[model samples]
Target: MKTRLGCLSNKSDSCSDFSEFLPPAQETAARSLKLSTDEAEQWSESFDVLLSHKYGLSAFRAFLKTEFSDENIEFWTACEEYKKIKSSAKLVSKANKIYKEFIDVQAPREVNIDYRTREKTRRCLEDPSPTSLNEVQAKIYSLMEKDSYPRFLRSKMYQDIINRTHAKCQRRSV
Candidate 1:
């Protein structure tokens, strides 16, 4: 049986091609989160930590991309941006765009929210508020925290960072 990550195999070629646009991991690691290795481990254990850290968020995004669930994070971030819109007109337009792109049933990047959450979001769009997607976003956040976060902690990518950080620290102390 093909897994979600397995399904992304067809996109690997494109992912590789596009990856060239990504900053080097070292740069991303240093600039993105700015957390120490110990802090990174701690951040990996909690959603709020990861969300607060740019590097944690970037790493999580990379992990989600591998699983083909990057849409969840993307949708959540879009909702955050939508919430920050000051112009009423822009709020409505951006909210609708986000809905059609990630919340709509046939959306190309549909997230794994429940029907009730989806329906609630749709209703919220009728009179869009900054808090419109708050509930659904929380759900998505919980899903990532509970499911993907643990896997990320165990991932080789994460481990390698921890190892490198430890080695660097040891060198400094010695």
Candidate 2:
């Protein structure tokens, strides 16, 4: 089945190279990432914890990319950034941009929202507010929490990080 981000084959070969899932900058940054064992386990505590942690969020985003569902996080993050805009003009412009990119019917990065939520988000573009995208963003957040977050916790990528972190801790204590 096609996911929220884009379609990819089910074969593990499709994403065999983890670097293919991240941009060049992120690949470099992630390569240098050194996550502690304690912090790695803490990410599994909740989706919010994972997102609030720099390395945890990066790893989750990479996992989502491999699953072709990164758009959900991108859109959710964009909505978060959108809410913090203090300028009226900038807020309206960003609202329209976000709508065009994620909420429009044929948006390149359209999220898997129902028609009602999509239309409601669209209507807010006319007179944008800090909370303009709150409803749709909430729906996306719930979807990720219920669906992607669990799979991410169980993903090989996440497991690898935990194992590697544990090994590193062991070496330090040795």
Q: For every model shown, what is its TM-score relative to the native structure? A: 0.78, 0.83
Across 1-174, the per-residue lDDT of candidate 1 in tens digits comes to 123122124333211112222356544334333335676677765678877776567667877887778898898889889889999999999988999999999999999988999999999999998899899888988888889888888887566556655655676699
Provide the clash count, candidate 2: 0
- Model 2: residues with Cα > 4 Å off, grouped in runs: 1-33
- For residues 1-174, could you state the per-residue lDDT of candidate 2 as single tens digits? 133112123333222123334556675555544558888899989999998987666667877877889899999989989989999999999998999898899899989999988887788778999998999999999999999999999887677666666766787799
Lowest lDDT 10-residue stretch of candidate 2: 1-10
Candidate 2, overall lDDT? 0.77
What is the lDDT of every predicted structure here? 0.72, 0.77
Model 2 TM-score? Answer: 0.83
| Model 1: pairs clashing at backbone N, Cα or C within 3 Å | 32-55, 33-55
